[model samples]
Target chain A: MPEKPSVRAVLLGALPFLAMCFSVPLWDRIDPIVLGMPFNFFWLVLWIPLSSLCLWMAYRVDRHRR
Target chain B: MRSSLLPIGIISAIVLLGSGIGLLAGSRRKMDLEQWTVGGRGFGLILVWLLMAGEVYTTFSFLGASGWAYSRGAPALYILAYITLGYVVSFFILPPIWEMGRKFSLQTQSDFFETRYQSKALAALVSLSSVAFLIPYLEIQIAGLGIIAQISSFDRIGRAPAMIIAVALVAAFVFAGGIRAVAWVSILKDALMIFAALAVGIGVPYIYFGGIGPMFSALAHTRPAHLVMPGATANMGHAWYISTVLLTSLGFYMWPHTFAAAFTARSAAVLRRNAIVMPLYTLSLVFIFFTGFTALLVVPGLANGDLALFTLVRKAFPNWFLGLIGGAGALTAMVPAAILLLTAATLFAKNVYRPLFAPAMSESQIARLARAMVIVLGLLTLYFAIYSSTTLVSLLLLGYAGVTQFFPGIVLGLYSNRVTKSAVFAGLLTGLLTLCFLMFSNHDPFLGINAGFFALCLNFTVTFVLIRGQKKNRLLSIPTTPRSTPK
Candidate 1:
């Protein structure tokens, strides 16, 4: 039988969709607060690498745990 | 025209040449058919993540998402919404797939079906359906590459040359390296895509409105309808948004290439990690979404929103920056094109050539056959790209609907052991026939839902009924292979 779906899994899984939900509103707020860069530009550049970092960490956790 | 020629040629040369190096590097490695096809059945977390990212985020996401945002108004957000949900769906589905792959040493999705149902015929059907759908899909990527080259060159290069050159370069790497070459090149492609998307997402709003908040507020004032939920138009509505999310979420895992990555994971945990953080890729879309809004804000009479991104890039950036962005965008198309070509080649070799022509062929012989198929498939897509009138999005969706026909065979093979080999074959045949009928007839069964979504509906229904009857007849499933401990 499949194990119970965890809260962590659910949160991680839903993050992208949730981001889609709040993206416009998030853009509205972050747009003005950039460090001389456009918020959209800052957001993706920061988030993509950051996301890559998270995936890397998750990979580590899974590997170490195994 | 001559001035732009240098930029276009430079960009194309860099991507093509870099990928060529990667191809040589891959071929030089002591790799076999298994390694080339499934990365030696033990791809580490990073490589797996990069490869999966390469497969999922294509020129389609770049062009289709932004174009949807531009043309459909509010409903365009559904592109982001559905893709995010799709990864979430993958988290649950992939674990068992990984375990199954490990236990059986499965190389392809159809191999899984073949073993589970004990049916070579069902495996053949899945392979045939996948190759058929994937060819058109590969053509769409080639088409997208041609479009970017055309736009970036500012018409300095003709369309036919662009298509031929792009196809030839992709075939070169794919024929040389296989999965290793694709994975390495994808990292570069992803970086460029993220950078370019970030540039467009932020640059347009910042230059146009001083900031994003003010940008939206400006849009709100000019066309508040576009600003609000359900968007700025009467045609876009809540139903379309919700249904698109539903369709894409379920259909995401249906693609053969996505499953092809499963056989490569070093561990089941890698698959989970990929699913957990994959959503962050959606961050790239925020800018694409903003770019769509930028179209609404700045470009008037914008019937085509996809052009909004390229137009903004050409208008704002210097030649060097535009050249870099064009190279990056071209990489987005090229990386996927390599993978698709490789995958179609593998499918043809394993399912078609091996069974029909070389029944006693060794692994190396099969690998050689796969390489030959890749070259042939690449040429075919090049021909179609040059001659066909089909737009990128249309060709993509047509391929998608056809591929999604495999959903039933895939799902039942994993979840229920009771699905008979004959029952599974019948279901697949019926599903494929129904999908082809609806697609060719232009009769979308699920009110405004795409053809793929409609086919998934029929595929699941028939598969469910067939499995239920098989179970009643005591045609129980053979037990799945025991899960192996991760090395």
Candidate 2:
């Protein structure tokens, strides 16, 4: 049980990588501009905060175990 | 030449003002190894956040990021991708590094190796290679500043003289203040850099293309592929993007200055918190991309994409705004150059020189030698900048390729019990030699994948095989789990 939270934390941390990088092709096109940026550019910028939120959740999960 | 006075004068004034802040910050504490190197390891959350963020937002982000976006098209997205992932890796690794740093008074990246692996030879290898790699990195800053100064001055001030003046000013402050000075000056550099990036990011697009959407619309209409992967290149396609992102992110915290910056934080929690919020700083880079994309359309056929920002600014804005932007760009280079010189000097004097050459040297003597090495290194890189013709983006990639080889040793050694000093040493030598062979032989991005990534994988494999081939495990991991500190 002590290590269970870390597994969850690691999974949460991987979320951003999945969104921003691992799935580049799924959203790399310039079509469908969001907030005035091409989809490729917009996807990357959006994931930055999403990445933070993921890490924040990981921190919370790990902290609960601690 | 009358146009040069306003911008040049403004740039000079701001440079002096920043130098003044550095000198005053340096005055707060007496010179010591700890104070000069790691800000006495007392930086709180905000200072630590800026200190780490400041290094990431170097001339690379200011110029190289924009330049690649302009010239290389979608390949530059790798910069944004790698940085965001870099913090994800750091979130797990840096706190452990900081925790160990506090436990054993580890001051440099090489110290982490020396203490962790318990081998002086491995420490020396790490030090020598980091310093060697940092040369190109520091050169980019010096050359980037030189470019900013020369262009912003309307070329009346020659790149050589501009580089000399700016580096000498940087040397004056680093020579006076140490890490505290660098941290204090980060305040100024970050403020101006954020403003300048925002101004250009928004201004160029709005004035020309009516807004960010229209700018991209124009680009998409004109050159549709430029907004997609492998845009404007034979290679650097999706696979290259994926591999390079992996290489850069894994190797991000391995930079000597960055790894050592963790030591300056007061506690591990400070570092973890910093990581939580630092990715938000990458948002500013969105504006830089806007600026670069605008430059691509507005100033077509410009030979050097690195100068896209300056060329566009010079063309569109008034002279005073160029001067202010140039001043911001100058600081964008100097702050990182100061820290790079400091880190490389400390690595050489403390790790390589003391451990390999002068085992009997005291800490005070080593600190003094490190201080002297700062000037020597500053001049050496200045010489390289003046004579060399390497472009800004290539110079950054070259440095990343070499320093990144350290990634395997540092990261694997952090968690794995079987990783041995000898194996890491062997792997580092193999990695560096492979890197040199590949780079000099012009095989980088070999097979549509980053050559450095190839070498890194080989290095990791070598270490893993060696460790697995052996029968022993030393239980080298300091702690198998994060030690929870009370709030």
Candidate 3:
């Protein structure tokens, strides 16, 4: 049987948007550079893998529901 | 200036190699419509990954991406944001779409629309608009080809003639039944693209301003605003950035070609895992951004930003290295063009022509017409490329604004059967007209938000308001009734 995405999964989906989009203004400044890249640019790159991790966790949650 | 044979030579050789592998891979199978269109819907996870990766690394990413970084600065990172967002959204939509495709024996995206809403007319509207939007997209690939050839060959070869020959060559090979084999060629294209991007990304910055870190530090000292939102432009601030990201990410998979590519997967499980892993592809784009940044610092005043990468490569790298980069860029342009041409033509032949014009047309006739449409569409896009050589990024954004009008209908239809076909039809017409007005009237960033996003909001509102007014309420839309199109 099919099921809608769980709250946890949907919220987990939101984490990427939160980090990448919503929090953009907060991290938009290029100060205190991390790992040699600007804070602003580095912040988004940092989220790529983190977003995958979030989605993977979401997938697991989705699978458990199924 | 005299042209060099080396870059053109390398481009020709790689394109030939791509077509060769495309032919070899598909030589074993008969070229039926199903196989021609969706690779028999049998692509496993790895093949789907390659094909999806092919979809990602288009001429837009290859050249236009770096161009944006060169011109726009931090605003270019929206490309990075929206792609990851697309994969996030796809994880939910694709599995369901896949199940529907499997159950209905659906071949194209328009078929999905038709089956869902129980209306051939809706499907025809979809086919018409999607093909219309795809033309500008296909234009960039052809235009990108011309640009790469012109820059790499030192302008000895004009853009128009080069695009004509290259597209004709690819269409001929694809017409001969090598569509599926293009996946194998993608492996080469992706590898070379990554290599070119990394080599330039790391090498250019390092050569001029030390390392990547030092490069940014240098830029911060020289042009501080280029590292943040709005970047070089005053208007494209955080709000503009967020709106564009939302607009594009939602629209990414909505492109008819990308939607069809998702259908090529063997199973829903494959698609779920694909979404989990696909964000990794965006990391390669960061390197492309680095190349563009370095170009901004090193050679600051090229008339066209899209030429940044090619211009830098010509100045910095050896002749053969320039050839290698150009070859990879050529494949990046052509591979995606192959799929777009195929998708648009298939939509035209199967969904539009077969149903609306000739309801009694057989599958074989549809297949034959699709093949002929490929040649016609290729020439048509070539003409557009020659006529208006807009910046690659704007062409895509304009196209995105149009195709993304489908999102309300598709996503809503997935969750509920309550949306009436007339409502979606009305909503699409409204969204397209709003975009046309906003874009043409120079109000694209109306009140600092993306005009496309605004139109999308209006579309949703129209669709929802109209849905409430429908008397029939929820239609059963039973999945078991496959290939049953009620007139």
Candidate 4:
């Protein structure tokens, strides 16, 4: 059987959700359009790729730990 | 032929082709209950991903997200927030649940509850609640399919006939192909949905205002609040946003179809990988939102928010392109509707009817019964779809509030053993009752939080208190070898 994921990896996996959920106040603005998208839209769009990366890292760490 | 008929013809043709593909995919499979409902638990990563994506990006994401953007403004972003956070929750929750499913040969979500709690009453309650909420969910899809058909055909087909046709197609494919058919059809639907979303998302803005930036700039200049949350709405402030996101994220996998779909994964790792990747699918909604935001300017003052996407597409795109978008929209509704019917039928047959009434029913007998239930349930949802006049997004949120009540029981059963069956059962009942009372009484966002959030808090409190109380009782009741303690 594969080993359990480390506490560190599990916590790291949670970062994307924390960033998206609690950072709502920070990114709920319309200024500073990134690549022609509003900040509100850009924040979510940016997190799409970033979330995949975070989960990928989590997957790798969990797999490696196993 | 009229120009509008061109799009209608193309859309009808594509939908028929999709149904044919779905039927053919499951033609050779065995018709056992396991094979029918859970795809024999043999789906690989890609199939699992597609099946999940198919379920996640329903008609709601395609039309309702854009509709909300057009109508409610920034509050619609809660859809994006909940979906991504849902994946985050699933990453932790599903693997263990999948493990339990495989170990115990579980077929449905209620089976997990039944086996874990060792109580048929709990399982029965779960089965009934799932069916109750699922009706509304199925209604959303059926209603969406009807809307797509009527609008895309330029009223050539009326809503009732359109809903009837859509429901019949879903019922036929689900009856013939079961979960395998749903999975296969989802592949086609996902591809078309992505293509359609990209086309409308970018094409509309570019056509109307030269580009996406220009489109947003115009909206900002004219209706800036529409671009941010609590935008133009009074009650849907930050608190509503946070509570909604949290409630939906927690409740995401609680949908019986989503819960049952986890069993179809070939392994736990497949589920883990899917969870990691699924949030990326939310990117599709961004493009969908773009369509909605663009529509706010191009086609202002749509009476029904759900009509926003269709109105914008009809106005901006040509006949052929409109047909493609309509075809995509129809499949989005049909794919999820098939799964919902399948899951509801399985829950009724295996969990409710078999346990409560026909314990002696054989596997094949149950399978036959489930197939029949699919037809019955489909027709019933068709009736509700044609008759009920609730908004699509609110219908979904109502379902979420009810289903999320399953969370306390499921999570406790998964991670802890001390939670008594009575406790879990009471907690679920309380949560569900709270939701019904709040929703029916129009106390949504009661005390600055969504009704669902309050229901969940009450549920967790009841569960925690009961668990601790039970532990204390057990300790006190046990006679602890007092003489041996000295030794």
Model 4, B1-487: lDDT tens digits are 3478888888888899889988897899777898898899999999999889988899989888998999998888888878987887887788878878888889999988888787899999999888888988999888889889888888888989988988899899999989999999998899999899888999999999999999988998899888788897878877888888889999999999998899999998999899888988888889999999998998898898889999989888888888889999999999999999999998888888998888999999999999999999998998888887756447567789989999998887765546678888989988988988998788998988899999999999998888887855552211111212111
Candidate 3 versus the native: TM-score? 0.95
Query: Per-residue CA lDDT of candidate 2, range B98-204, in tens?
Result: 87788789899999888888888888888888887888899989989988999999988899998998888888888889988888888998999999989999999
List lDDT for all candidates, in order. Answer: 0.71, 0.86, 0.84, 0.86
When sorted by TM-score, best at the front, the candidate numbers are 2, 3, 4, 1
TM-score to true structure, per model: 0.86, 0.96, 0.95, 0.95
* Cα lDDT of model 1 by residue, B91-166, tens digit: 6678778777777778777777777777777788788878877878888788777878888888886778877887
Q: Candidate 1 has which clashing residue pairs, if any?
A: B35-B40, B225-B232, B226-B232, B417-B477
Ranking by DockQ: 3, 2, 4, 1
DockQ of candidate model 3: 0.53
Ranking by lDDT: 2, 4, 3, 1
Q: iRMSD per model?
A: 6.2, 3.9, 4.1, 7.3
Candidate 1 residues lying further than 4 Å off, grouped into runs, are A1-66, B227-236, B391-395, B448-451, B471-473, B482-487
**Model 1 score (lDDT):** 0.71
Worst lDDT window (10 residues) for model 4 chain B?
B478-487
Q: Per-residue error at B321 for model 1, in Å?
A: 1.3
B259 in model 3: Cα distance from truth in Å?
A: 0.6
Better of 1 and 3 by lDDT: 3
Highest lDDT against the true fold, candidate = 2
